[model samples]
Target: MTDQAVAAAVARRFFGRQRELKALRADIERTGLDTLTGRKAPRARVLLVAGKPGSGRSALAEELADGLTDRYPDGVFRARLTEPGGDPVPTARVAQELLAALGVAEPPGAAEDELTELVRRAFTGRRAVLILDDAVDAEQADPLIPDDPDTLVVGVSRGPLTGIPDVRPCTLGGLDAKSAIELLTAFTGSVRITVDPQAAETLVEECGGMPAAVVLAGGWLAARPKASVADLAKQLRGLTGDPLTRTFLLAHEALPATAARILRFLSLAPLGRADAHTASALAGCSVSAAATTLADFAALGLVSAADDGQYEVPGHLVPLLRAQLEERDRPAEVQLAQARMLERTVRLLQSCRAVTEPEGSAARRKLAGLPRALRFPNRAAGADWLRSRQPVLLASARLAVADGELDTLARRLIASFVRALAAHRGAEAAAPELYGLHRLVLDVAERRGLHRERAAALLNLADLDARTGRTKDALLRYRLALDAGRAANDPYAIGRAMESVGGSYQELGDWQRAGDWYGRALAQRLARDERADQARLYGRLGAVQTYAGRYGEALRNWRAAAAGYRRLDDLPGHARALSEAARVQEYAGRPEESLRTCEEAVEWARRARDTRLQAALQLRLADTLDRLGDPAAAGLHRAAAERLLESRAAACEIRSGFEKD
Candidate 1:
């Protein structure tokens, strides 16, 4: 069949709701537009459609949106306010989705209030229809409502959404018998229904006028081309209790065992949505098998396929499936499924890090054994995968922790997430996720009595705090990490904590305390023969000394750092040390010495191919030359610095362009 023909066949037929539709239209006409102002009226008009599950509230709202497409010329925007499992969707997430739909670009970590304000501003003068489907309560719908009078918002929930004001409430129960029969005929074809009109009416009555039940029954009948309407009616009569539940059971029971098992496993998936990889992980099957099962379920009306290749079970059926799963009492099977999913996620995250990390790095080597399906084709695909799966990955971590029996998996998941995010999005962009993961790891470590892990988590959190400029908090956390490290007898952790503590003090302008901590860390590094760390600590200590006006001591430390880096064959480290020494020389009123040091630093930076460092050294050289009465040379250096900076900026822009794609 043609795409248009299929769409027309499945298109929602508005049946037996003329009164509700009329009332909704009247509400929209009365308050949606301000005739006097010739624009959308101020203060949004809300039409609330409240009904029981499967009562077609969302379908009704969509029908209304379709009818008013011309009135709201901007567009009709829709957002699901609840997950399929009936959890209220986080307002921040919903706000982000709406902003994206409105074509507004927001930062990845934007706060809820910021996104809400952005949504409001986006609809300030626009004429549009905003549909909040399956809202858990008024609270979930409040921030999403546009304040503009011209735009209309239709909120569909199971309750009245009483807390929201200026709402026109419409309560829906079920379709009348006539409309239900019509709906069935629309699905089963007019010829079949006309052949047995009485049986079709009996089937509609048996469905209790619930549209979802009627549709599922019709889909069942449509799937069986030779079955008469009497056959379905007789089958319906044999079932007892809620028609919807009975209908759901009938459809579920007809599935093959593997498909049925996959359906149950999907009940445990977050948001009731599963892609092929997720299905494979849950079902212990190949990706192709899982994909085929999901497609079959979609065809059976047991699930819906999204445009992005995700299949979601209907929200109303999630509870039923979960109840059935609970009754099966297969704890071991459930745990196995969870483990498989967690393990797959960890492996995928590892592959994400592998593709994004610098080539030939240890991290990349660690990910060598992953199967082809789990590995991304390139860094861009890896980054996109990480971005798309972040929510489900985070949900998995939360679920593992809550299960309590999967503490080890929880810790690994958190660590893998942190590493993958850092590699793909950079440290600053991934700071928030890192912060949360570190906290989770700390909890898990304490519970598992893993002191070393606890210490590492503390240090990681402190590093993030310092990076984000929370010096006092960083200091406190660093001290705690030091204590944990000592308790764990980990010399490396202790050294790292001491260095971080010193850095925090330096940021707070306490040079004396910074020097003491840096000295302690440097001693440990020296004792351990950690030459690279010692070189770094020398540069750190020299900067503190320079800040405290001990220029002579600072110059000595910087020279020692430069010599150590030179011996280590680290050109960038040597150049950075020379730059620090030059600053100390200038502070000590040694202009000629500082100029020579700056020149040497610039040459080393060039050898390292560090354009940014070269530009910085050129500026420093220009200052030194200006002080030494060489205006002509200073001008040349200044011009060189500008050109280098421009080139660096252009390179950064080009890299950013690739990242966006």
Candidate 2:
């Protein structure tokens, strides 16, 4: 069938989206209404049909194009941005290609705006439909959209084109059961469907209303002439027990031997917003060869254009590809190829995250063959690379874990990415990301029975929990980590875990236990000559003593902390020492010294931009003001404290001493 014919056929038969189609039609009508009302149309010229890899996005785009065809007389233009292997074609190339389709004679150049203006002019004064298929994002597709009032540009993509603000995004999801069944019946004989109606219905349900899988299942039954629909359903159940794979195998198995191997290899290929280079590497061929293979797959509806030159497996086909990959009993050659595939992606990840400062020759060897783009030309480029590849990095970690290689690689990947992310985004901002990484790291470590890594992961997780006020859970995890550290005979880890456990106890108002643990942690720090850390421990110990009304002991510890900080020459630690000592003095009714200490703390705070320290000093001044009977000044300081607390909750060193349940 011709491309346009197929696109038209796909549009006409779009099913079970009566409500959604109406909403889309209504949106389209609104655009027309604005023109008729002689008012300015919404500045948004782009119509985005956004959804995941599958969920019938192309069909929706085609339907919208078909709906607008009679109104658009200039001509309908369609461009595919992804190749079969899910690689992204560049925007410049796509824009140039799109212009060519619009009958514009123009040289592609570095000037993006000039090209955009030229493309917009081609469709001027004529109503037309422009379908931008398999777009990577708005940056890739939005440039091609016409500014003309008569043009309707529909972009199909796996995710939101967040870069565009005014584009009316019509998000598509999976097919409903009725549509899935109808899709299945289109391929399978109706006689077979009606003979065992219940089984066919069950089969459709099993496909999760994913049209591709349903059609594939029906296709498999079509090839098996004598197989009853019930029998085929059972066979499909055994095929992968997943709608995605169940259908993928039905079609993949029908391929010639070489193509099937290529398909499975493509399945294991690093899927991301990829470029032609990765797709070529996956196909074990040149870029042109991979491009041709991608075109073939697009023709078969098994792949789509993800971007200008990128091709991808249909989203729903991923699971099936994975299933097909796992089922094949391959020789060492194939296994080596797969390992190389993984290594290539690992290189990409290292370039994107740049977490591992090369530890040895082997690490360097593993990363040597990466694309130069991964090296990041500048710091801004590196930051942008990490942001651009974040999703791919996460998917790589998950793929490794799912493939039972977590013990070897996934833990390190999670830890390295987690650390990198934390460094880029300060801990307070990245708390949620850190929590997920800790969970994944711990799981991999436990699965591999690597106690040291497990303990480290547990400690990190406990810290997040404690900071979030889940001290009880934090206490339990910190103890577990401590036990693991002890089992490994690691003094540094054990000491740190002890301090974490103690901190949790302190938050729960268990001063005696907090003192004990802090003492132990301090002793370890002293033994290790970690004076900087020791000073912080002493401050924590002093705060617990003060909160328990042991003013003298608190002063002794605070003074010791002050001496330690002075020796270490840490300004922040020095400020904390002064603040704690002042609080202890105030509790002991030495307001004169307390007032002097708070003044020093405020001076240090102003230099440091330590709002928490300023808040504490303000509260302390308010307390002094109360004792001296200065009502208005005290109330103003109290209000300032409240505002600071609300604005800087995470940065503030809150004195939380909740009673244990």
Candidate 3:
């Protein structure tokens, strides 16, 4: 079958639940449409499918959705309400997921109630089907369900959901004996069943009509094409313990040692879905070997191949695999697996940074020797990968924190996440992730007694706070960072904290305090021979001086900054310095000197390709010419500035429209 055909078949696979299916259809029709008004009925639009573990509730829900696709033309959306380990998924997160599927974006860190309202608004007039699978209880499902009668929600769980209004609950049991036999036949092919119908029936009876058990049994039989069905049935009949457990044990024991070990290690993967790269890390083997093992597991029905080329172990089987992993009790092996995964993540993140970082940057140079496999081809691909894998990376960082043994790895992971976020998404969009990562880094640093790391984390948090308009909070964090840096005896950290504190003070409009802090930072940079940092500090000092109405002091500082930038061969810095010097000259009533400096600034801006800077310089030159009573020259400069601004505005509008489209 084609892939679509196979997917459709899987969705429509209902062997012998005719009675339940009929009742479900009846309920959907009865509650869905209003005969009196010829419109959607005013009812709680929920169909609850309740069943035991491995009883195929999820499958039945999918089949029902497939049958009603024509009814819900907007689309069918699915989300798991429980984690792979059976823990309840957070309600806010479920709302976020549903809202995203509905093409509505909620703000970062939005409240649960806000997200719930957004979901409700999204479904207000939409005809959609929401299949919330593996739901733990009604509390988990309440906020996610839309109140719109036109929408339909299918809630699948291990038992009936309570507290939901007017829910039509369909409780399911295991498949019937004949249906179980058909399921096995569907998996193992009809030839084997036709060869020995009695043995197939016996095997179904032994499986107690459980679809999962029957599928695994069929997989076992399918793996051995020459083995007689009668012989397999006899072997099933001879098992001494629970049939499901025995079947799982038999399937697991039959695997080669390497494959079995890989399966056990996969139990540790978050969400029970792992790609070849993750499997390679977990199994401490080559990616090729891991890919082969994952494919083999998919063939054996131990896992399903996800659309993204990852493999997902069934939720019902995760507990069993975890138990088997614990039974093996190889702490050393588990530790090694974890370390390898962390290392692999680190290498991949390094490559992401390398691809996105500016050319000739220290960050790019540091990643020069990264392995080819981990490298991304371009910035766009790297950014796409980072966006797609963000959740996984976040989960891995949380896991590292909980484990505590990989403290260094956790710090590195969080740092890499911050860098990746800043590279792909700007600081504003990355604020929430950066906030979380900085907190995590602080936790790791404090636990490990790494004073320098703690100081760095504090500084980063302070910078984010300042950027987000929390100047007071930023000031507090900067002080803490400075204290920690002093304790660590790191001049660079101390200088950074001082400069950041000055920035916060400047944001608060405290020019005097800002100048003082800048002077202190400059002292440290000079003592450490950090010429680049010293030059930047000089510019910062000049800004505070200019704001304080000290034109002479500001001019002196700007001149020093220009000299420093020239020494460092920084064209943009020199241009900015020249612009500031011209402003000081204008304030000092030296129009001729200001005009000369402004003209020089314009040339430097052109060399730096900073059109905005050039535009500002032209305006400054026009102002100086106006003060000198040269109206004609001033008019020309003003015209040039207006043209530059118009062009910039047009470019911005074009970009904005493109983004909107």
Candidate 4:
């Protein structure tokens, strides 16, 4: 989607921000609208929309960005600087997300400074608008500001961005009476307001002219269409304490018994958003019933229907709901509700992954045993659900771990999340989120002193670090994993950690240390009689030896790997090992031997039905033959390689066509 379209879809309900918008526009104009006129301005103009959490700061900023899309034709980009748990998102992560939206491929594992530079470079020559939402402070907002004259940044925050230079602050308060009444009418209809105009005005006043309060009051009246504005006004007047609180209490009190119970349980929603599945799980009710209740809640404005089809408790109402929950429910009851929700979420997550498994597999069989209500229709639907619920799922994991008593459930949740995400979106695509989940697991493991779980979490996190080029960090985590594994007597973790340590050293260009660690890991695998791991370790040792310019040693290790694979009946592995041996032969100045090795590898690749591998070996043979002064054989091999490539391309085209059809 275009960035402008993304910004426009940020929020759907905007009622009274005209004065704020006008002031923001005037600030932009004062900085020079030269970018709109096809000329460079002095610098990017920043407008900070500051207000309390419930005051609609984010929505106002979104509206402003949406309106300026024409002036900033390059496009608009938006990023949330705060996480769901109200944690400040790291500057690097914010930069990475924004860079992706800007169509820039961020270098993996880049530090904040580098990513900040990339963000600046992306906006350097463009006349675009960027919306930085939920910024907590100047530190979180400063690095993201582009240095381009043609850019505009609208920052949304609960307070002014104190140290940002030249930021025009537009502080928001309650909405105006007319706009507030209009917003209320949108929910309650004009008939009730018209029937008793004075009572309607008094009701809006009781709501303190806050859009959220007005919506809740309007919703209460809407649910009871026969109720008059004066009656509702009198009810609010009778309540005590905070206006918003009183509004929430009155609205909540108006719910049916079951609906009221569900509303109280909604405080358990991760990020204040829940769907039918979770609602059913939380309340121990049927999915359809929960769905109906949620729909009713949406109609009553107790919750709003999100674009993802889940119901979201308005940000302002969340605290009130939480308060009500604490008051009406015992701690034990709350914990039970949370456990029920998480347990059900785990089952649904399992079903999500089971749909992707091959039919008749254990996973699929287990999925079949689950009630139909828990199972997704197919892989596509499951993946879509998983993608849409990503934020909530992550928040669930965070809550589970923080609870300190649901370690087992948290582990299952993380494992299912990892496998499901990998099956649907690939681990690399979801690396950032996976990284956070792993950290939570590690935190729980460390606190509980569970060595095995700690070892596993460490290894997983270390692998992610290595994939993103943080070799030193990976090395440290690998060492810790090794210690944890030893403490827990986990042979698999021990062997894997040793091998990973070697890989990290190899990445750091420490050939001797890499070889030593690989040899150690190889010994562990051999001792444990792990044939597959032993073969893999041999290949890794060969790679390290090759990097060290020890051609003979590399050849010997590769030959061992090839023999092991042959004994194991793994044709592809045998072919790959032979290919590596053949390359080393060439590197060692034995062209004839390399040619012979390549020929054998090609036959093995063909036997393995690996078209790409066979084609690659064929090309390698052609080069070796040409070096050996056999031009005719080289030409034939080149033609054979071309045919293999053509066959592979044709097969891919047919597969694509089938998928499309």
- Best-fitting candidate, scored by lDDT: 4
| lDDT of candidate 3 at residue 153, scale 0 to 100 | 91
C-alpha RMSD between model 3 and the true structure: 5.9
Task: For candidate 1, list the clashing residue pairs, or say none.
Answer: 40-150, 41-149, 41-150
Indicate the residue-level lDDT of 422 in model 1.
Answer: 87
Tens-digit per-residue lDDT, 513-623, candidate 4: 999999999999998889998899899999999989999999999999999999999999999999999999999999888888989999999999999999988998999
TM match of model 1 to true structure: 0.81
Judge candidate 1 at residue 214 and give its lDDT: 85
lDDT of 2 by residue, 93-141 (tens): 5666676567665531224676667876787776888888998877777
Pick out the ten consecutive residues of candidate 1 with the lowest summed lDDT. Answer: 2-11
lDDT leaderboard ranking: 4, 1, 3, 2
Candidates in order: C-alpha RMSD to true structure: 5.1, 17.1, 5.9, 5.0
Candidate 1 at residue 305, lDDT? Answer: 71
Runs of candidate 4 exceeding 4 Å displacement: 1-17, 32-43, 74-127, 571-661
Q: On residues 1-661, what C-alpha lDDT tens digit does candidate 1 reach at each position?
A: 5322332456435677888999988976664335555764457889999998888888899999999988899999999888777878889778877886797866433468888989989998998999999888887789878888878999999988978876888999889888898888766778899988898888888888888888778777766779998887788788887988888887777777788889889988866778898899999999889988887666556676766677777788898888878876398999999888888888888888889777788867766666778878789998887877776777777778768888988888888888888888787766666676787888888888888999998888888777766779889989999999999999989999999999999999999999999999999999999999999999999999999999998999999999999999999999999998998999999888988898999999999999999998999899888888999999999999999999999999999999999
- Model 3 is weakest, by summed lDDT over 10 consecutive residues, at 2-11
Report the lDDT tens digits of candidate 3 across residue range 555-585: 9989899989989988878988998999888
Off by over 4 Å in 3: 1-44, 90-127, 143-151, 160-166, 191-202, 226-243, 348-390, 411-439, 461-477, 508-523, 526-535, 538-612, 621-633, 640-661
